[model samples]
Target chain A: MLIIGEKINSTRQRINRALISKDSHYIQQVAVDQVANGAQVLDVNCGINIKNEPELMSWLVRIVQEKVKVSLVIDSPNPDALEAGLKVHQGSAIVNSITAEKNRYEKILPLVKKYQAKVIALTIDEKGMPRTARERFDLAKKLVKVTAEHGIPAKDVYIDSLVHPVSTEPQQVTEFLEALRLIKTLPDVQTICGLSNVSFGLPNRSLLNATFVAMVLCSGLDAAIIDPTDKSIRSAIKAAEALLNRDQYCASYIAAHRESKL
Target chain B: MIDPKQIAENLINGQAPKVKELVEQALKDGLTPGQILKEGLIEGMNVVGTRFKANEFYIPEVLVAARAMHAGMDILKPLLAKSGDKPTVKFMIGTVKGDLHDIGKNLVGMMMEGAGFEVIDVGIDVSPEKFVEAVKEKKPHVVGMSALLTTTMPSIKTSIEALKSAGVRDKTKILIGGAPITENFAQEVGADGYAPDAASAVDKARELLQQR
Candidate 1:
């Protein structure tokens, strides 16, 4: 039930525009609107194309935290930028990721261990992803065991079960759901899914995606890669939790409704 | 009794090679995906999300972890799909006219899917006429509109106007968002709801649909 806001990343057109033009005002608003609408974490991606990622990450962190009390998810693929952002982080934070690739781990995990920050672990490895649930689960456990050697506990890590575009294989969806159900049982782990990847190349994708999310939670996914900007999907999660008895006494449901009329 | 903290640390330090293997090992050893996800994965992401909200996890990290989680789901999705399950509800969404921004729209779309709702994304640059047409054809319980520009923000209003004109507005709930959008704007434009971020979007969508 943790909502990590995905806006404010430089990959988006507007943020990219803001980065290109050095438009601090527009960048600040991305922080503003997302926070106002109830984003607990503002994700800051300075874009792979930008030159000054560290400085931008620092600046974005300062601006967003200034506006709201929410934590920041400083995301980037560059190890240098991720570390640079980590250097300036004022409070508790999550390191966006660590993968099974040796280079990825060699580059990323030490920082996470150094900072004791929570990390997102992808099930993929050096070559690519496994084709079956058994292989996937094996990799996830390997990550847990390997990271434990670094003194980071398994509980501190989150496993991202990747969601591939459905356009490639219809049966993959079925495979995905099965893995999701099984993933919930991993020792001291949380399962997060990048929800958008499923509909890539399909028509009327949003609907297909929303429907898919509702179906997956039966496996008890912990977090999602989602826009804090979309209400329909948010509404769906809240409603499902309430109806499914995940939210005791419907407290979250009522609060969600009330907070918005604001 | 679950220690989300320890699990999170193991993940951060690369104790696990991949989240999927960790999950399966947990299952074989009698741990549940729900337990692992909640105590470890979810708990760890909570740490990540909290840091994200606090400006601690930078863009690369979020993207990386998001990629990681996407990787994990490649293992998890099929299992969940056939777990003798059913979708909680159904909704349709699309980007409003004159706007090509879709990352946000797409994220929300996926969250809904994760939450077990039927979501239809009509793609970017969707028009009001298209909105009405889809509503009629799909007969969805809810409709979502996205606009990233103040200039294009009007398309959200216009789409609703189209829905109202088509007399199908009342039959479906409408939600709105984008950079220039706000709660007041959502109301003014006649949307029943608005989500500021993708996580809450799923929460909102769930609440609204359940109300009906």
Candidate 2:
């Protein structure tokens, strides 16, 4: 599975403070650490100060890329910030999201096409979040068709079923897993989710999150926006992959074990 | 024989039908609508809000409890209005322009309703002009703005500015919040109050009104 490091997002208090203070060293260390811990892509979000987002996004894109070799996921709701980050981002970056909301889709798709970036398409529209597997699948299908029409291929489109808090909506996990299975039936599009949202408002969140990750992997999740530095979650991913026979002869699991021992 | 405490307990447990039934029973047994509202619905929702803040109750629980509160409110609303016991404070809420997110805003609206405020949700992607127009028409005691994205956060200030230019800024207390909003940001934007979460939004709304 592709692991998108979610640590550099400015929503967290520390990251928000760092971004506001222009702490380049703190931001770079986080990027380097995630990549070292097995993140192949880092999601950089500098949405702390709206007025400074464009400047901060580009600055973050530049500084983080200077320290790491991985591709990036420019996560922002602001088209300006996305463009600013894309302008400076070196590899083929992944745009964090494009939703089916008419205005958002119109505003973000051209940027994705212009930048030739892979895109994460969320199952949301003007009506807000989908409440069932059918709703999610329908939105996913629409996103795939729309992005394809916009000249972005299905393979480059990542469909996020949008995990709701299972604590709030107990059936949400079942619905999410079902949606993932249904989404895989679509032609060549990838499936991803933010792991922590499933465990929101629940105690022993890490336990719920790790277990949910295993469940989604079993349901054919291709990628996850997650804290790559979470040891338990990493172990869960490796173990699940090995158990599901996605790992060849459990080689990746053995390598992980050896590295941990070292 | 209807006990208001029983009504409160049923509301807390999210038994909407039971809460309504008990409120009806309380009224039929000579309890005032005000008494049932205070000792039953509001009393129950206060526990819900406190538990939510303490991490004991999550969104599902709070939402369910709010539904129960609404069920009881339906029984008392007409009677209260007839008796000139309408909810004292009116709150108008919306997600600022360019932001379509409303989960947080909805939560605050529900909590405020539970706290006995008459809430008018102007919905998401509300422009500054819409805010100014609503402030003029609704004449709400407090105006709350929400923005989940850092990109949309500036719209809060813009809306406040619009209200100021329209000369309606002082007519209502402005409260700002969302994932990206901070107390400092609220102050910088010249808002009257800021709350980090939905439960506190209720307290802040009450506190802001009291200061008026």
TM-score values for chain B across all models: 0.72, 0.98
Question: How much of the true contact map at the interface does candidate 2 reproduce, as a fraction?
Answer: 0.58
Per-residue CA lDDT of model 2 for A168-188, tens digit only, reads 578878998999999999989
Compared to the true structure, candidate 2 yields what TM-score? Answer: 0.91
The prediction achieving the highest TM-score against the true structure is 2
Q: What is the TM-score of each candidate against the true structure?
A: 0.54, 0.91
**Please, what are the lDDT tens digits per residue for candidate 2 over residues B1-212?**
89889988998899999998999899999999999999888888888888899988888788889899999998899999999999999999999997867678888998898888899999999999999999999999999999987778889989999999999999999999998788988999999999988989999998999999
lDDT for A108 in candidate 2 is: 90
User: In model 2, which residue pairs have backbone atoms overlapping below 3 Å?
Assistant: none
Q: Please, what is the whole-model Cα lDDT of each candidate in the order they appear? A: 0.70, 0.90
Tens digits of per-residue lDDT for model 1, A111-168: 8888777788878775566667766777788888778877788778878766766654
lDDT of 1 by residue, B161-189 (tens): 88988999999888777766778778877
